[model samples]
Target: MSNEPDQQSETTTKTNKPSIINVAVAVIHHKDKYLLGFRNAAQHQGNLYEFVGGKIEPNEHAEQALIREVAEETGILLNDNTIVKLGRLHHDYGDKQVSLQVYKIELTVEQYEQHKYCEKGLEGQALTWVSKSQLLAGEYHLPAANKTILEWLKLPSTIVITYPLTHFEAQSNPKGAWLKYHQEKLASDSWVYIRLKDSDSESVAEQLMKDRPDILVILPNDNEQYLDDKHFSTTGDTKTTQQVVAKHLTHSTLIQLFDEIGSSTASIQSLPKDYPLIVSCHDIASIKAANQLAKARLNHNLPPIIGAFLSPVLATQTHPDTPPLGWKAWADLAELADMPIIGLGGLSPTMAEKVIMYGGIGVAGIRQFHQ
Candidate 1:
């Protein structure tokens, strides 16, 4: 609820009063566990479980304040190098507005061993280390600080795309860029898809999978017996490379798969909930369509789609004629969508910092990693 417009629901009655408080929130994570503390019962929204952090004082940078807050609230000390940017949230609590920068603290073995039991109910706020599962379940009943943080936490920050053979016919490499890129990227934690566009797609898929069986191999409607755990079947069509590669669960597609006769209606309610899905979205209409599909799926007790690839964030050679979405447009559309999205087209891994700032999970591209 942090960035959602409905954040007013969390607001207190003192809507006339005005105050701006900048906070640095630390999601101090060690493996599967994260540290959280109870809020002071005397303060507004008292006794609620929330991440450990404190207000940023004048002249202090956000990261510096996070380090100070963690050391003060808990015995564990942290430096700028140990912190990773998780996300940011802005909450308008009626009278007082709050801007919070969230971070994940990376600790060393020695630090964990020394400070594992070093924290207490400092300032009369109880502290507990909870597992990831407990955090996901509504066990903590976490305040409206950053509800979508959990969703972003479960997803990776990068998505890799295979450079379709045709796109690179004009260029060449020593060992072959496509094959070499696969070798280089497979070492990371990013999700990858070998876009089924080549003339010998089946053969290309085999070689790529044989080289790195971990990558998700996307091949249109047909499924092969050898495609055991590697096949990423789609809820959309596969007539063209873009259509099949993006795996769009179009409204019609959902209607065909999930809609019923009689009083029933067209909806995406029947789409697989647990299965990993990555849908392509080019503009606002696509984003809205995805949102509608997600709403239907949620009504059926399904989780939101995993990732949306927003294209043309910058003008690119892939689709040179399409107008650019730019950063603001991309951010606006992404905020409207229900799930985590990746900024695609004309971006490198470095764009991840900007992508996150613009409300996207991270960056994805076809040629960036390949080069």
Candidate 2:
């Protein structure tokens, strides 16, 4: 056999530092605008705008600490229901290290203004609301702590892939079912990968999303829209194309991006600085490649691979003989990832809660999620 690395081998690295100081950060959002703070000249990383948050006290859970801090910092009250963990971040300032337990905070339109009414000089900064487009394009200089927030935007909670050519039994027609899924699912603001059996089906899925253009749709089979395919269009202005997540790209494509660079980590430095770039990984090498790419982006001060899907979590009809990464192994793997990791292969939506308990963002599947 050739000397190719074991595709299944584990090469991804996760750092655990007990001394890294924990900081609870908030990404307070209302409507489509995010609440940001302009760091005053007196503070650390002064003059740079970033998320408003503070240190976590002893014996305090991240959510509780975030609630207390936000109240103290902005005079805004955030309850448990309005908060969700985005991910974590470890940043070294040379003098000391900080481990940020980041969370996404939501509030009503009226209450969103509560931040502005706060006592002057709250947390020694001025708070302002900014749109995601400006923030993602690097129009503003936000502190490094905001990186993971952008990463989580790429790592959606539930990623539903489109079904094959055969029509669903529950519905009389296939198009009807697809429309229903879009109507019910897309209404909540989520991401879906339209990997139809052929171009016609993928085209239909694209048209269905025309009305609700806000939802993210990934087209894996269409060459023109597929970023990894030949004749790939890099049309950032097109809403349909902008949400595209480059999937299952070839080794050559990555090599070309970083040219002669053996380190996958180094290659990541070439990705878009503010937006996320995603690729599918089946083995340890690809995962490590993604890890390197993420590190490389961070190294160059850019947005890197936000997350990845660990495939074949359980054996299926297509690959019944392939040993799966069982629940514990999958969960353990999730724990190591700094970004949200989604489980795939024979996974069902019902199992998503367990996946979260084990550290994953959620589960994705082809037939299991009734693709």
Candidate 3:
């Protein structure tokens, strides 16, 4: 068995007062299957399944600790260059609190073959490769903290953010074409963020949900008009809102939310725990505010904002007058975000892989979706 210890004990070693244990978790992916270990019953939150990783030593970089812990536990070496940050999450077990630095690593064919037959980790713990579908369907048990990680994993690498209705008005049947365009996106994509800047935008969004109930729809909740239905429930016979997986709050909306509720217990009480939130962030302050909302939600055992869109990664054709954040500046902004960052503005679906190289989980665009 591996000599490394579980984070539960290390978390409270420093003081009697509550201290957060810093852990580096690796979501090692090979195709659609994820490598996981079954924790021994003796350990904290043990007897359940967990990703391959351990606590971060004091002053050690998260990447360095991750490489060491994964190697020690699984005998699979990780290349820092290939590691992609999937952002972080904090969870309190009441007895102990933990801050997990999540990272993603896609294993090569050879690597997957090398480890496929290993039923037990180097630590003697049983290891299993779970498919994405099984994991999301709750076939395997995992800790509460790992719930948000699953949501991040569920997001596609390419997200389609639709253009406003005005742009589609040139078509002979504007409303019909608009809904059809986004509905067709579900053919190859799992997610679509409908951004309709029209007086009847709400109706259009509702139509899309009714037409494609299985699509993971993200509706724009940037104003008061969109806020009333942000929380969804299936209690009623047929609430179209039940089809939505999340609500997209622009940076302005986030500011207004923070200003009004001021990030207290009220913030957690006001937002629905069942519905996920996504935000638009441009700079450090906005990202910080989004993080505050996420942390507050998680504190209440709720799934936090699943992601944030950091826009203008490159200069756009429609907004040539505005300067882009560029890759370096974009990465800098992404570093401050605690949720998966989706690169928006002048990015194509093909650039999804490139976006991961610079700290974003996916790419979102208006024009690219139409193309």
Candidate 4:
């Protein structure tokens, strides 16, 4: 995690009382130049160039607020289709904490200046198209505004989709039906599973190339009786799934799975340095798994280990146990596992919010269908 403090924390943590409702800003751009405006007031006035946006009202959504603010300040009518939610920033400004839902809008330079010099200029004094590189050079007036712009530049352009790899088949009766259903629901970037057959562990690499293609697959020990490996083979499958995956999907997207810490550590040792691994744990086994892997220093070499299915309260025939811990447990476990964690198990978009709030990478769901 970056050591820099979140700007929203300054405003949010100052007073014990709950802060006002959310506000936001949109970084409108054209080519390499950004649209910046000078605040007319004293608090952030005097040549201060900031992204055009402001406080969201009682009944307004963040996106709606952004549109209204932009138009109100610069007389530019922004359509809903022009907006894209990049991410959010939470900052504390001494007395109040503000959650800034950041967005990006692309518009032509001519359109921008038309609004800037419009007869109905409402709030800002001037508007200028500044190159992103120029903004990075620290010529901006407001320090916080500069920081926000810099942070936006650092964020990835595409939203990263992190998913879990589970042991499932496309032909195992009810299980197969469920697997196929979920597989179809997966986002293009989401992770999927591939079980290695017992007969030819060596051919696992070849099979992956032919069937699953670029998906990250879980290779379990073949035990014939253990639920995970009942259908797959475990003997002489010494080459880690990560190794096999690395060989086939070198430049493609693929993440391997390690059921327990012992296997994870061993797999890390056997696989290439760059092969991604998904560390899984469900039940008491996770404690030993994480501890052993950490002890072996395998966690140090591998990429972030996404948390697999974990439920604090197990569902029973009679009734459900406690409510799901959501990302709290996953966050805690990820800290111990020494890797970034993505919440799995029964999760929804609402649950995913909690996962991100608690410092998780993202959320993956089996029951939820992808649009």
Query: Which one is best on TM-score?
Result: 3
Q: What value does the lDDT take at residue 335 in candidate 2?
A: 52
What is candidate 1's lDDT per residue for 1-371, written digit by digit as tens? 01112223443346545455678888777787787777655555565778878777789987898888777777677863456555455555554677667666657767767666745644545777788889877688666655545655665566667766665475665226656656665644345655645444454555555566444443322221232222323312222222222233433443343334223533243343344345677776677666555545434444545567777799998889989899999888877665667788789888887887777878887777553
Tens digits of lDDT, candidate 3, 1-371:
22224554454655665577788899998989899889788877777888888888889999999999989988898863388888888877778777889998999888899998899988688999999899888888888888888888877887777766776778998888887877775544357776666665555677677777776677766343352354333334255665567777888877766655563577457555557888898787788889888887776767678899998899999889989999999999898888899999888888988998899988887777654
lDDT of 1: 0.60
lDDT of each: 0.60, 0.60, 0.78, 0.46
lDDT minimum window of 10 residues, candidate 2: 1-10
lDDT tens digits by residue: candidate 4, 130-203:
78778767677653523543533532211212222223333455343434544455455334443333343333
Model 1 lowest lDDT segment of ten: 220-229
Given candidate 1, what's the lDDT at residue 10?
Answer: 44
- Answer with 3 or 4, whichever has the higher lDDT: 3
Local error of candidate 1 at residue 61 (angstroms): 22
- Global CA lDDT computed for model 4: 0.46
After best superposition, candidate 3 residue 271: deviation in angstroms?
Answer: 3.4
**TM-scores for all predictions:** 0.55, 0.59, 0.90, 0.39
Q: Where does candidate 2 clash, by residue pair?
A: 163-371, 265-292
Model 2 TM-score on a 0 to 1 scale: 0.59
Error of 2 at 120 (Å): 5.7
